[model samples]
Target: MSKASETAPSNLADIDSSAWSELETAAVSQQSGFRYVNLCSVDAEAKPQARMVVLRGADRSSRVLEFHTDTRSPKWLELSANPHVTVLGFCAQTRLQFRLQGMVELHGSGSDLAKAAWVRLPTWSRMTYSGGPPGDERAFEAINESVPSRLADEAEGEAHFGLLIFRVRMLDWFQLRRQDNRRALFTYDETGALAACRWLNP
Candidate 1:
């Protein structure tokens, strides 16, 4: 095995807050100002569902995590009923991962944040918002194949978009190394205050 791989942390609590924050900052800064996170939510059947999604932004100061998604997706309904969720992210280049647990809130279609986020979207992404409700089970042939002109025009409308905001409650950071693995756990209290932090053997 490689020396770097051999030193990776095996437990989740071996890293410190400062190190964890640094890793998070680096992950957010690399490539497109977005990070892919594995989002986990509870279905109506009480089963856990997980999917990979792009992280739009993170407010470390406020402990807020933000991402965009279609309001018509099942995950949106799932969060509507149960707001608790877990988001996991891994950066291959850094050999680091973040597992965060929090409550989610879906912003309204016409909200200021939604409008601003929509305005910032490029034409290609705006095209996706024009696709209509996501996850609809219509027959393949019955689907609307015509691309809306507004999609290319970059005009925002009722069907344009939605935003998902997650208020992070806890964050676990893991770093992979060749000799030993390092990990750290950070918890925030109900009042949004930082709770105790600790390291664990990875």
Candidate 2:
């Protein structure tokens, strides 16, 4: 069992704290199970689109999370039309699942939030945005092109980079165990303060 499962929270308040704590840890830990989360948004056709995104920041006090994406990606367009989104992550080792409902604020290339996030990205990571728009078909030869090396080359990539700030409104936390399962639901007010919490049958 993982350390999280071994030290599971026994109360609602602790469970809320643990959920945010784990998310904050995941934001900085590549090895964390929650490091890559599924972000779901609704497209223009009213279809649900789900994609995996890296967790870049998590603020417990503000009940906000951060992610970065290429401005040309479909998900970016989808979220632009409808900011409402669902972020989900599960840890197999810990037998824990977190489902968060939130609204995303997009920071475009010229925004300070996007610029700050771009400055923090590593060279290799920044290279991803330098290529053609995401989902565009490219020849194998084009795919093998050299990555951005010069400062000017990297700067171009920053133009396609954007930051997604998700303000969480509700969280559903679930823990699976052999003998019994546990679940709790928490809702936050517009100011990010806890509004309500309730235990649910699992």
Could you tell me every candidate's TM-score relative to the true structure?
0.78, 0.95
Model 1 accuracy (lDDT, Cα): 0.71
Q: Mind giving the per-residue lDDT tens digits that candidate 2 earns over 46-115?
A: 9998999999999999999999999999999999999999999998979899999989999999998898
Model 1 agreement with the true structure over 1-202: per-residue lDDT tens digits: 4454455544433443443454356446646212666899999999999988876676666677777877778888898999999988776655767788999888867898887877776667666665547766667775656655864545544454788888888888777776567677788776655776777677
Top TM-score hit = 2
Question: Which ten-residue region of model 1 has the weakest summed lDDT?
Answer: 10-19
- Model 1 residue 179 lDDT? 53
> Model 2 — TM-score against the truth?
0.95
What lDDT score belongs to each candidate, Candidate 1 first?
Answer: 0.71, 0.92
Candidate 1's displacement at residue 176, Å, is 1.9
Q: Candidate 2 local accuracy as lDDT?
A: 0.92
Off by over 4 Å in 2: 1-3
